[model samples]
Target: MQIMDVLAKLGGESGFALFFMQGGWKNLVMIIIAFVLLYLGIVKKFEPLLLVGIAFGCLLTNLSYFLGHGENALYHPEIWANFLDPQNTAAYHSYGYIMKNAGLLDFFYIGVKAGIYPSLIFMGVGAMTDFGPLLARPKSLLLGAAAQLGVFVAFFGAVLLGFTGPQAASIGIIGGADGPTAIFLTTKLAPELLGPIAIAAYSYMALIPMIQPPIMKALTNDKMRVVKMEQAREVSKTEKIVFPMVVATFVILLLPSTAPLIGCLMLGNLFKECGVTERLSDTVQNALMNIVTIFLATSVGATMVADNFLKLDTIKIVVLGLIAFAISTVGGLLGGIVMYKTSGGEINPLIGSAGVSAVPMAARVSQDVGRKYNKNNYLLMHAMGPNVAGVIGSAIAAGFLLSVFG
Candidate 1:
């Protein structure tokens, strides 16, 4: 068969054919990546729920053009049939035009493109979060602040690696270990890098247990790791009710740009804390959070088309993401050490992992590490103090970057 004839059988000449010729090789690469994400999420239980859905979502948009399904389709049944009849190519072109004119994810992606998904998520976070631990142990806030060292370090690293200032800022926020914060910053500063940054942030967050144990063990001795921390005092209900509002007002007053994330986050917490608002809080935390998570994950995953996501820059993002994670880990450990020294060695260093702001993941890792050294020590509660603080600290860092660069 002639080369041109062979090419014709693959998909027939047109934009789809050109797309295959241009992006087909990379499409296979992304499929392999999706399978890996699926395997990691499934067998390993690494963010199983999210990565599974997101992996399939990534594969969907990528495999679409190959099916001759046009730009966006929930279902596309024309694969071999488009090639068997050349007349159909022209016929489908007319249909594809109609679909394009109809508009699909173009609007959906706008929500992502404009930085709306993460803000909505922060609202849900406020509703679900328990600020009692943070309020009871304000010093843990320092650990959260220390964890952000990695963000600035990674920003510089990205710049050194040839990314522009705003792009580097977007990439570095991944080190904050805050997925929504990373997305929020990226959509504003470097939307082009959003797909890889979001995926990498969430992936590393899910991998926290695997990544942190060795680092914690390497930095801590048996006695220090085993050091028992005092249980946190039960926080007052009044304090919980007021904390989010105070923080939100503080952030909004000082840094209005940060209010989008902080305001929604605090408002959710307000509902959670307010005794009269259980029904509202429950809806915001459980129903609303889950729904937004589905939309956010699938929509973000849709952006991972092979042409956009499989560039040389994707490799750089992956590498930079690893750097961000590693640096954040180190920063957490250092914060633990600093706090331990400040308190004359009373503070357990494991709490430093919570500084990365992966919500409970890093905190859980701290608890596990403490348990390894002493079977009964429950550092999870204590680690939570720093864990939540990291969220605020990262937000502030994001704000700083925005203020300086925006």
Candidate 2:
């Protein structure tokens, strides 16, 4: 009788037995999804740095949700749900309560909820980035701004689909092809939708090589793709140093909500451009970036607790994200075409597709496509003008959306 009782207790504690319970299936399903994401990140190498961390966090959160009982669970959704509830005013955005009751993920999530990680990530990006290309060709700013057309288009589409203003804004930012900005905006406006938005943003960013090529080919003929121009004029050290300060002051005055991201970005850029701050620049570019990425990715992934992620809304978000990304590419290419015509075929329209802010990757795509048509055509430096500009454009667009909706 004693042996039988012990055996029964052990069986009840097992994961298989838990699967029979209500809502247990959702956890199991999420775990499977986490496994698939892991495979994609590890085997396929899709944004491996962040994706692998996110997948692991998802796996850990879901597994702990079931394996641990009550207050001991690695993530407590109820805590976050309460944090967002108006009725629980005492607990609303209350980090104290979270720190007291929630688990490890909840602790790491503080950086995410407080908007620390993404801003720091921007700082790192700015530290590594050289705005010299943008400074050389001021026209690249037009292409970058034009690429943001998808953001507004997707916003209106989301509204038509019955999403609220804030939700739509969060969804629209995926068009920027900037994961940090997307995560930053979503956390502020639609915390509930963070899981879907973050995944969509990163996935589309990783697929830029595949997604942008078709759009580039469809929009441009051989002549447009092959056109190359003279080298950009050199940018002086003074222009590089003054650029970040002037932009930060002007932009922050225009939209105070942008101060965090824009300020940090410009500050990082200043560090890189300023001759004295080599150590600071290197730290942000390497160590700080790597650390913050791990925290941000894992925290974002923890939100993928099955019940929140497996909805029809998730599918809708994925589809809309793809549409927004495609449209942004189209918008950039169109802008490039206009420049090509206006310049009497001196400008290569293929370079315009790099205006979606995926850093050097987008610019490289432009170079690859341009090379395929005319091997002598070197569009990389020209394409970089718009590539870096897209980063600023996306941040400004996010600031606008936040000003209106936040």
State the lDDT of candidate 1 residue by residue for 1-406, as single tens digits. Answer: 6987977776664444555564467767777888887898799887765677678777666666443345455322232124224576553434443334432443355455556778878888878778788898898888898888779888999999899999999999999999889888887787668779988898889888887788788887776787788777788888887788789888889988898889888988898888888898889888877877776776677667666787888888888887888788888888888788788888999898888998888999998888887898999889988999998988988988888777
TM-score of each: 0.86, 0.97
Alpha carbon lDDT of each predicted model: 0.78, 0.90
User: Per-residue CA lDDT of candidate 2, range 1-406, in tens?
Assistant: 9999999998987667776677888889999999999999999999999899888889888877762344446777788889989899889878888888889999888898889999999999989888998999999999998888888889889999889999999999999989999999999999889988998998888899999999999999987887877899999999999999998999899989888899999999999999899999999999999999999989889888877888998998998999999999999999999999999988888988899888988999999999999999899999999998899899999999999999
List the lowest-lDDT window of 10 residues for candidate 1.
Answer: 75-84
Q: Which portions of model 2 show Cα errors greater than 4 Å? A: 1-7, 66-70
Tell me how far the alpha carbon of residue 261 in candidate 1 is from the true structure, in angstroms, after superposition: 0.8
**Predicted model with the maximum lDDT:** 2
